[model samples]
Target: MGRNTRKRSKTTGGKVMAAAAALTLGAGGLVVVNVYASAHESSGGNAVKRSSQGSSQGGTGQAAASEASTIDCPDVGNGLRQVPDQARAEVDKQLALLDTQISEAYQRLRSSTRALQQDGNFANNAIMGPLKDKRVATIDRIATAMGRAGDRPQGLESLAACTLRASGNQSDTGGNQSDTGDDQNGGQAGNGPVAADFVDITTVQPNVTAPRMSQEASRGTFATQCGVNENKLYNSDNVIVAPGVDNGAHHTHDYIGNQANDAFASNDDFAAGETSCQNQGDKSSYYWPVLRLQDGTEEFDAQQQGGGAEGNTGRILTASEVTLEYVGNPGGKVVAMPKFLRIITGDAKAFTNGTANANAAWSCTGFEDRQLTDKYPVCPEGSSLVRTSKFQSCWDGQNIDSANHRSHVAFADPATGACPGGFKAIPQLVQRLVYDVDAPSLNDNGRSSPFYAVDGFPEQMHKPITDHGDFVNVFDEQLMNEMVQCINTGRQCQ
Candidate 1:
């Protein structure tokens, strides 16, 4: 909640947007013809899958670390919902295909939606009726599935991403438009990243609103963005769109699929926060800010093509970044904003550089992003990005270690009888802070910490410091132990 950083003003029905985010899928080959008008809400999209459709290798979901142990959300279930690795692998393959298809469809709908909205001739009554009908029909199908998900609620990403597939069946708004032609013409319907489908996100849903300033700010107000993952219920995904936005604000998040734009070979594999379009001008980092308007739709705002980026990537920086007060969702679940995971990394230049370091590395690629997160987004160039650990004033290894020593307790190894050295167990109190409130958690949705999960999760983690949210309660020993138990024994998880 840095007041100085968040200068933008936004007022939405008096709801304060803490650190919220939204998401938008790349358009291509996706065909979501029906639009629903029901207010019946569901949670999250399907689990992210990897594709095998293209000649390209399956976009590896996060790489599995044999050394890494999955934190059993014991409260979530008695290991009943956990899918076996083999089954999980198959899911990844299917997800990859779905991602590709959706990417294509995303491009298509984006165009159609924009045309219907921007084209003065296209009236809401004429276009929106069919759209609403389709939306309603689709929502019914989605609602039925949600009803079937049973009492064990699924992750918001999974529920939101219902399995909707399209075989590039619909006619693109810009008929016969291909990638090369769109690029040569520039700003044509297909000029943006071509989706398997047609249109950009804005056109289809004309009234779609991104996240805005909290009313809290307007009274000459103040605010906070992502907290220390304290509140489990709120985050970008948990948002319930207003009653009028998407046909009475249908809550069933309908999704087609996804694609891996990870063009960098040195890419650490695809992760959501970074840009895929190779910067032509050659800069260190691409600023892609995932934003959400009041309506609850998501979109990508990236570095200026003027700064060597591409497409609306340049036009997007209008708000750039802004922190807000608690939007209700303490940290994860239903954040008021659109998307999660703010930046790709602290080091701008070497995101692809430390590809040489096998011990621990950061990645921008979708597949590689999985395992690297445990170590966090460090690059060979170190922390050069602003407002991150890499910043000049930020602590070095020694200082960081010292801070941990002062604030944290020794991590006791379960297998061994001794406590960890130079390492501290993430006090259960702090687990939510590190897991839910940190930068990665703040800006990410879909899969858990697709990154982050590394070697010493429950037993030892980074000390709560600058990176942790402000809600860290030093005196809350009981709360801390609760968190510690959650970390060590996976207790009281829901």
Candidate 2:
């Protein structure tokens, strides 16, 4: 698919990435009518249903127009200024229908790939083309229903345009993010050998280090019941916006355990969220950057303008599988974690800094000994590719939020995986990510082939070893206590 840059407002400060676009879309504006259709379908009936409540404000305009919103479109806001209740209802119904139709089409397309080329053509015309028109029409109806008609353009494009113009930040695009952070750096130049330049991981096996701590090196272990989080579900607003910014991660994130991922979500929210963990009492919420393929296809395609998920500029897809494992103190001694504590493991900017920041674990099925650094393995037909993230397990006795994220907690010793002398030992959390993709080869034509890289990630990611992990501890007090107990006593609890 062609890549389209999204129209973004400079006022948001953060660069316009796929995640940010998703945040904008999720914040309000255009509703994703077709994204969740399959999730709400009735097995015995053809009728589609809505899953979330209406808008939260209980008023009209874009505020009350989201698929998961609870607010009702009010009769106010003058004509064309706000979405009406009746129109909102109608648009929502159509969106649900669109979801069902598109999902069915995708399912059919997935049944075979014998004619990859022919199938691709059919997907574009028979599926994508019609879906695009329906989406555009749905946006138009929203504008017309709100009385915006000619005043506002089709899709949320109109809403975004107005927002940018009103903010007067259109000309204020001077603040480009500095390259110091991992998000900006593409890897240090002339530092070490580029992991990608190597052939397969096996060739460089001796150079790579497997990120594993033997039981003898640790006090205990915290194991997770579910090795992979495969359910097609996501909720962005559940988490808080970035530290100073109003919107959280700016993109939609797949969340498991605690459903309430929003910043404003409290310990109570964690307690109340539905969990997929074997232990229902474990209400810890795990999250990470949603992985997208180079072509912009994600596990759940939102079909928004651009590609991938809604608001994304490329075709991005969710990882084939995300393994949620509880990081237990491999030493068998566990310390309690402070409430609301947050930590990011593996550097998101590793691609820019090189191996020093790249401590993630990676391997492909069948080829075990050949560890990987920056290179991805091109597996044979029946192999599995996987990525693992091990979080820092040592924490300072005090403080949850810190100026330097790493300062609050530190990694255990590599030799023993033991907490430092004064630091507290907490359950280490690791996210083992698996994808159904392999390394790209030179023989592919037209588009990049075999090796599927993440959309928007740096070039290093294209090589495969750039895989890193990110995390936040949104576990409630009760869950943390249980983890501490299990780790401290050397008990292996799933």
Candidate 3:
């Protein structure tokens, strides 16, 4: 697939009334229509409006309103089982467009406060109705493209109509969150990481469990030293998911390992890219959403499309430490991963898509055993914040990529510690990121201590469940074979 250079521009603040319309004829003469409109700001100059019906401690009315106010649409990409090579590009493009539509609709919902307060049917009529129409059209294009080459997907229209669902930021009854905050607008961007999105680490019970290993388990570990993105390489392009589309990820990503990775990078480009690791033979690319401190600081991309313009504002936080280790599978002997293999662990839209594919694990440095998947941990005074991602360790032994970008890989079974039928055990990439920022002060809604959030799609609300990571294997063949041998032979090697 070919890609174009990234085109970025700063979006102005306040009410934006721009409407863009484009019509193009794709391969096989399919008509592709794209329409986008910015949301109107509140007349009172407030970016966000909090419900006044709640108390400081436990207010059901306000809490219900806050929790129930978010857009929920079925994930069309997950429903796809097979996409022909001829239609894969078009399908991926349409999928990315679906994500953009949802983000825009969510933005409209957030900005139109007065309309929502004045009219009961304003959201359904103005926001959701139009969003559904756009989605239906995009979904149809996907079906048509696939039908031309292979069998068309069924029941895609059922995924078009979205509904208002909970934002997954509701405060736990026993969690520490006080509504008596001075900052009313949800974070610095007026979108997310609300007071209810965090919990004290000390209160969470230990939940980490190890899978039972058998006698045939591969018991070695190969640790690769990739710096914590010290050079600050970042981009919003997702080559694995959206491929040729620029800004496919509505949020920025911190990149390490393969320096030549971008939307336009080809397989040949990655093979020839510069390396950040001390071992030049390993050139695999590792990236994830950049963590940010919502403290009113404007970084370089603050006003750009994937940054503040998309409700991802504040100062980008670089991980104090990043560990990339390929460990042996608990199931059996390991195999070398094919070059250019891609894997996406967690769901970036899990806040609305549900937690079926969510794999984010959060904890404090000392309390690593107690991991939190849905809520950010308020670490103690000295402990640092940690984000860990354990990638799928079982491969189909055939394709490097899949139609949904996930069907090609699977995680080993937890109970039996066995790979699925016809699948082979492979080295599991365990990524760990540590940050030294102070915990947010939920009592004051992060007024004194700013709330930190992982950058995500605007509609995802920056919820911790939406945290995810991306990896592309670009290791030299010799180095990859060595990694596989070390893991299978039970030898710890770097």
Candidate 4:
């Protein structure tokens, strides 16, 4: 199925609910609307209350009274299913520009508190109007490039207009907002990760289940020992998504496995790069956004573009343990993944794009059975925080990547554990990261104890739901065959 055809489905109030809406720009220009559904209901326990405060890092503290508001634009990248190879580069550049535009507009919204309070129409008149004009021109360039190479994408102009949306923190809040006196939200930039973003793991019921294995199941697993990013390799460039764009991710990523990965790294660079894995033949690149503690300390990227300057501040916390394992499909034997196969498991913009592509799984060490997708888990004293990502296990067996960077691979069926027709099952990379950090004290909005959040785009508000991971397969032919053989024979190999 196409990426745009999929809808986010969640089980709430004992019934599965799927809500989706889209906006089209008319002759009048931009139409302001809320495109996402309400926040997921807390399974149990009383709702947490939140308050707005100025960010110590110079945020203007101008969110709406009830919830933090941000600019929401239709994701143009998600709708582009096809772009000719000749136009791919230009399309990617345009997509990156689109992201940059959104980030810039969001920054304006966050900084204009006085204007927002003084003039009710300030956001629509100043921010949204200019943003739509820029987007229309950028999108036109993309369409022209694609038309010159292949077919022009239709209905792209409809995506140019943007609107203001309250970040999905409505249902999660209850009682009265608390004033912590200290002027800071969980995030140093005051953009997000408020008290409502976290929930005690113990209060959440067990929600994970195992898929049934068939007789043809390839039950073996292959584990790669890539150290926990001990070398401290980090960057904001995304080679797979925006190959030639700097700060394409708008957030720093902690890299392991492959040593030579950045926005400028080509396929050849990845092939010739050094490996951090114990097995020299396995040079795959694995990276995820760095998690940061919202303490007052400034890190190396404090003054950098994709770091503190972009609202991703705080001390970067290296994962205590990083486990990269490839497991087989439950329905049948798995095939070797193609070289340079790029897979992004979660959605970094799930906060605005909705959860159709969200795959973040958070839990405590002992409470692994209870995974929290929307809320950050507050682990007890002895327990460590965990972030788990299970990558797409089925490949289309043709392209190494797609225009949207997601169409080439797909997750197995939730119930049947089978690959879609015409696609082959591949060994799925299951990454588990363990972090040792103190739980944030939610009552005072993490004032006494700082909140820890995964790095994301500034406008994404450091939402836990936006947590994502990326991987590029660079295993040598020998190691790749060995892994496939080990899996088919039902033997665990490393």
Candidate 5:
């Protein structure tokens, strides 16, 4: 979020704040592949397993302690829907492999779908049909593996039916055939800190629409003055690495705001920092690990490389623009966002843990009619790549941050989009990340293709369904007051 004082090579960390002291300035910061089966262990592919038991347990599933502690899973009745805990590890291992294979196949289909100009039928016949058949086979193997682990195997049908399918948006009109090989997203190519060679054409998927905000809030055009910019890379400055890492999560994150963000970063440190928010008084920071394409030739900081950091994997390009917006609670309610409040939205373990918390919206800049759920949208030329990560709007009105990082905040009910009992609604902060990556072309190889997908996140990341968001409240008392004032008065302030 700050400027680099000196130029440093890849060997020396490039352009970072000097020594965590710029006058204490601050800044800030899927899919479901559920593997919660009890099965026999099969050693193959990537040895990845996901557990929602929090960072401490090496998974990103819900941090629902109450649910975890109270679960006295009944003794196996022949028809019980749950699998035994003893078989979870082995089942998780096999499911992780399956998750990877399925995601890769989906990626291939998406690539082909775009290459064939949004021809869903063609892509399905040429790619998806076989992939689905293969998926069926994989599911059978997983079932057998789970049965061997001494657990009941009744959930295989759900797993087998969880195939990837993209809805055809009749309104989508293909991409440009031109290829200039120019890096147009303001990122430098050839010998700059930026990674990958971006194509010049901006793929536009017209008629795409943004995800629906909870009905509790209005779909008014009231937007903040915060606008969008390319230089604002939201790297992780203060977040624990994974559940167990002492410092920031094991992997590096692009963060916003200058505050200290880790277990050790005290509230005071969080309060004092430069913010990307237009209101300098507001010190909240937002962030997420950068998503990279694993094109073999890509070079990532040592931390981002897998087997190094918790929650770390892949080498993605820095985002093209980070759009930050602060909206009053959709329900027209406003409460002082309790200080030091932290809430993580989206299930990080959805891809591999069989959890259904993934709520991702993929669209092109102008494609208001064509939208894709849980998958990246292929944009036609002249349009930009866009992914929106929306957060839960309800708060429990009690805790700042929870042990599970999520239980404190719950999503509004699906039917009514309203907060549940004991929960208070707060401002809906949204992070819309736009990238330049596009559909596949004949020039690029599968592994090296410049496509955007979250599949490579650690097996624990729960790919495809893993697009998520994080938030922390460090607003100065005065700024917090202004936010309330704006909401209570129904005046849209930036």
Candidate 6:
């Protein structure tokens, strides 16, 4: 479900603060996980699940920024703003590394799981625990890097690019996007007041009117649909998503942290999955219902298709907009996000398969592509541009070749594709972006990466289910070689 765009935590926005709180077990990790779990269960049994497929986002400028990425910026009227080309490049580099490391850890986990199975160590959990430790360490490294890099924390900036169209980008109707061409520079190129209000909170809103806890702002269709906005959700706030949630945790003005939020994020409890797997002799929590729909031919619904039809919550991942409370109230401006997309579950064959070449569970679903793609300028079909399978794969398990692409990114069907026999499928929500700006022409990619997703726990790297630092480490090492060669030749930034 992680594309260029991701949740700051789990909420769709420009800030990339996503970490599943799975790494290194930060100080507050347990509290958050418990809370998130409660929220998941509370979401109820019947909410219409939708496609996690996201629509096209805004454009990244023809050229990348130089060093402007490190510059400190503030929260706009809400939390959305333009990122310098330098910042985008750095973030992309960081994401690349985190992606790689996590994949590596996952690979190790695979090996450990197998080792455990063969050595009769599953019951002892010795292999699993050690592998989990390694994974957590890797996640910690990613979190540390995020803190060091100082971008929209988490690997979320990419999600924002996917969600919030920078300025000057266009959106399909009802898709919440704009193309005004005005940016931080106050008029594009991020030339204006770059520093905006920034929000950093660890708990749900104590009170709506309590300073950062609450403020006043306009709410529209996008806000109602996505469940957050400049007034509530932020261009840079961390949201949480858990496997199970409890309704008892719901609180007043608690929209941001309560378990009740499960309704909006398209998460469906696996009651059926629990029942089915209960008799299979597998782990109790491993049951997944959406996967049951994999065999149903209703997988491909161009409009309102094959997601689990639970509650009547009808929201599209195609596009949406929400304004967070920008303390300065900078002219009461709103941030526009395009194409919100996310998966209900990350467990898939792609994870089971070490590299991309291994038989994927549903590489055709863009699921693997979403997890393994490199930089942009995808294939002719757009999505393929990020694929690496066109090259070759290696079994060394140490070095990962870029060309080892996922499936046919060029011909993916709608989120509604019927699963082939024996394939596992999960629910996903998709939506487009739309913008309601003060001026019609003021709502496009002001200056940022549409392919970037903002992390929810910008400060807490543990928020992302998968470590984002893995992406950065790999990217830096890869590009650094090129950079070192350029530096030796007296080249600054190519």
Judge candidate 6 at residue 201 and give its lDDT: 19
- List candidate 4 segments past 4 Å from native: 1-68, 168-186, 444-447
Question: What stretches of model 2 exceed 4 Å from their correct place?
Answer: 1-199, 206-219, 226-231, 235-252, 263-268, 295-321, 327-332, 353-356, 443-451, 455-466, 474-482
Stretches of candidate 1 off by over 4 Å are 1-82, 85-90, 102-314, 318-321, 324-494
lDDT of 4 by residue, 1-494 (tens): 00111121110011111222344333332333332333353212213222233233222234432234577677887776557767777778899999999998887866765576655446656787788899999989988988887656676787887656566433223333223211322355667677778889999988889989899999999999989989889888888877778889999999999988888776777888899999999999999999999886799898887888888889999999999999988889998899988899998988777677888899999999999888899998899999999999999988787777788799999777788888999998999999999978666423347778889998888888898999999999999999999998899999
Q: Candidate 4: lDDT of 372?
A: 84
Clashes of 3: 0
lDDT of 2 at 268: 53
Tens-place lDDT per residue, model 1, 1-494, is: 00011111111111011121222111221112121111111112212322222112111111111011111110111111222322222222222232223223333333343343333223122322233344334333422333343222233232122212211122223345343233212221222111221111112212213334333211111122222212111111101111111111101111100111111111122122222112211111111121111121122312211111122221111222222221111111111111111111111111111121112222322222222311233212221111111111111112111110111222233233222455322221111111121212222211111112111111111101102111111112343233333333323321
TM-score, every prediction = 0.21, 0.51, 0.84, 0.86, 0.53, 0.20
Q: Which ten residues in a row have the lowest lDDT in candidate 2?
A: 161-170
Cα deviation in Å at residue 83, candidate 5?
25
Q: Give the winner by TM-score: 2 or 4.
A: 4
lDDT digits (tens) for residues 1-494 of candidate 2: 12112221111111111111211222322232221112123212222222232233211122112111110111111112223333433333333333333333333322322332333233333443454465556545545644532233233532221100000001111233232111111112111112232244444455445446565433445665532445544433213213312122323445565554554454555556677666776566676555443333343434431123222223344566666655555454667777667676654334322233345556676665565554445556667666667778899887563422455678877656677778977777867666776454433221134224432122112333344444445555676777777666666665
- Model 3, span 321-397: residue lDDT tens: 99999988776888899988899999998765656678989999999999988789999999999999999988999
- Compared with the true structure, model 3 gives a TM-score of 0.84
Question: Candidate 3, overall lDDT?
Answer: 0.75
User: Please, what are the lDDT tens digits per residue for candidate 6 over residues 255-329?
Assistant: 221222222222222111222111221111111111110112332221211121110011111113322110111
Q: Candidate 6: misplaced stretches above 4 Å?
A: 1-37, 40-91, 111-114, 117-292, 296-494
Each prediction's RMSD to truth = 23.6, 19.1, 10.9, 8.9, 17.3, 27.5
**Best-fitting candidate, scored by TM-score:** 4
TM-score of 6: 0.20
- Give the worst 10-residue stretch by lDDT in candidate 4: 8-17
Cα RMSD, model 4: 8.9
Candidate with maximal lDDT = 4
Candidate-wise lDDT, in order: 0.20, 0.41, 0.75, 0.77, 0.43, 0.20
